[model samples]
Target: MTVRFFNFTDGQNVKLTAERGGYSVIEYQSDMSVNPYEAQLAYFASKMNVRRRQLVCHLDRFPSHCVSMQAGAMQWMSGDVQPKTGIRGAGDFARKLVRGSVTGESAIKPEYEGTGIVTLEPTYKFILLEDVTDWNGGIIIEDGAYLSSDASLTHRAEMISRPSAAIAGGEGLFNLGLYGNGLVALESSVPREELIVADLYDDVIKIDGSLAIAWSPTLQFTVERTTKSLIGSAASGEGLVNVYRGTGRIMFAPVATGHVSSASTGA
Candidate 1:
């Protein structure tokens, strides 16, 4: 089969950002013609670092390395690729339904198999690619951050050890968890360049908000008062904070001035 792709070559408006483990992040720069109003808006948007980005998944012929994506994320595909619901039976469907409910993800994420190129819909959010091995074979990502992942990875909804802590921290009851090996793609409002990766070894980290986008599941996360005493906490002008203890790494966007979301919910 012959395939020809345009606007992907050098000097094109659309360019590759990074490619690894069968996933490629393609960025669409603001080079297209637009109306005067749109031109002004795009100009300001570019100044704020907002741009269109897409995720591409390269599937091998082998079924073991197939890819699964959000229900409607696929924009287009080429080659002899085939998509399935990835449902084996009724029991599996029920499990997935519960998982989706808790994780804030699609229940039936479609799985693509065979050799092909699949492109996801473009969005203003940043596309991030991560390898599970880098997070010690498991990762807990914020809700709505998941885009796609190699089929080899196991996905589940992870509940916090302390549900009250989640409520106090302004977090959800559960998070999307990915385990095993392979690459996973995510959607983030903030670019990775602005993110801070904190690697801890039998240590602890605390934050006043839900700033963490992803973290190793090995970390014990909870919400606690800034100070043991409520009066002291009030005096400090800080209340409950998200605390992560044990050995692990967390990817968080620093709280800063300007327009930036405190967490990466892809909102």
Candidate 2:
């Protein structure tokens, strides 16, 4: 089959920002071709630094590296692609349903197989591709951060060490966990370039807010006071803080990074 794309492949409108583990991040340099009014709006949006970016995953038929994305995330696909709901049976579906309820993720993420190119919906949020192995083969992400992952990974709901602590920390009781050796895509308000990665060995790290985007599952997370005593905490002008103990890696934003609208927000 032969196909030709004008401004697209020519890099006039979009450019490849980064690629990793079969996935690529494409950033739009201009949004001036949608329509007359919309193009003008997009031009202004770009000037305001609100341009859209997209994620694309590639698969090979010879040694296929199938991927599962957030439900309804696929914008387009081509070249002998087949999609499945990732529902093996009724029991499995029930588990996933419960997991979705707790983790704030979709009950059934659709998986795409065979040789093809899968394009996900674009958004203003920054796109990140992380190596799961770098997190010791397991990582837990903040709610609504998940975007896509390799089909070989095991995705599940990871409960907090203390539910009350999670609530006190302004985080969910459970987080979405991705395990195995593969790449996981995430959407974040803070770009990966600005993330602060801290690795601890049998130690502790504390943050005054929920600035962490992802952390190793091996670490124990909790909510604690900045000082040992309530009087001391008040004197220090600090209250509760999110604390992570044990040996693990954490990627967090040094400053407060607000959330961006996501496709799977209400899904």
Candidate 3:
């Protein structure tokens, strides 16, 4: 089967932003305003330096392979495509339900198979096409990062070992973990150009805020005082900090990034 996109070219309204083994990131440009009131606000939004482009991903499937994505993420599909819930049995459904409850992720991720092209919904946030095999077959991501992945990969919920760390680190108690081989799509608050990656080798890295978006599951994560002594910690103007110890890699946004708040403040 052949696939073609109209009004979309290499550097026109749609552009190929990133690609890996299994998926590709397609950036589409469109006017952010739909009505007259929004048009006026869009002018101000542009002046304020707000981003307007939307990010979507295109997945190519083979006859024997499939693609799995977050529930309700499919915008459209073409060619001979069949979709399923990826539930093998009752035990698998139960496990997925529990994992979804703990990690705040969708339990029934939809899977598309057969030779086809699948398009995901558009979003203002940036898209990351990551190869899970690079992280030794497992990676832990922050809440809401999971977008889509090759059907070969599996998802689960991982909990922080220490209650104090989960309470004070600002990373919550549970995170979504992806394992196995294949490419994964992530919706990131910050663009890939602004992400910082650090590879540690039997060392430790500390951050004062919840900036790390994804990290290797092999790394030990915890929260600890900035200094060993309470007096020193107070004098340093820092208290507890999120710490990652061991050999692994971490990717994080250097600055704060998230959805923009509505302009209407209910004045």
Error of 3 at 28 (Å): 2.4
Poorly placed runs, candidate 3 (over 4 Å): 1-4, 8-11, 40-64, 259-267
TM-score of every candidate: 0.91, 0.90, 0.86
Which has the greatest lDDT?
A: 2
Comparing 1 and 2 by lDDT, which wins?
2
Which tens-of-lDDT digit does each residue in 1-267 have in candidate 3? 576767644655466767666576765444443698788766665465344433233444432368888887787777778899899999999999999988988989989887667777766667787887888899999888888888878787888768675786566788999899777888776778889999999999998878888999989888788999989989999888888899999998888865544211112
Q: Name the runs in model 1 displaced over 4 angstroms.
A: 9-11, 31-33, 61-63, 256-267
Q: For residues 13-77, what per-residue lDDT tens digits would candidate 2 score against the true structure? A: 78888888688888887765587768777788788666678888887722345899998899888
Worst 10 residues of 3 by lDDT: 258-267
A best-first ranking of the candidates according to their TM-score comes to: 1, 2, 3
Q: Residue by residue across 1-267, what tens digits does model 1's lDDT show?
A: 968776563546777898887888887678365688688888877677777777887787224758998988888899878889998799999999999998789999999988888888877777788989899899999888888998988988888878886786678888999999888888777788989999999999998787788999999988888999999999999888888899999998786423534322223
Which whole-number lDDT from 0 to 100 does residue 204 have in model 2?
A: 94
State the weakest 10-residue window (summed lDDT) of model 2.
258-267
Residue 142 in model 2: lDDT: 87
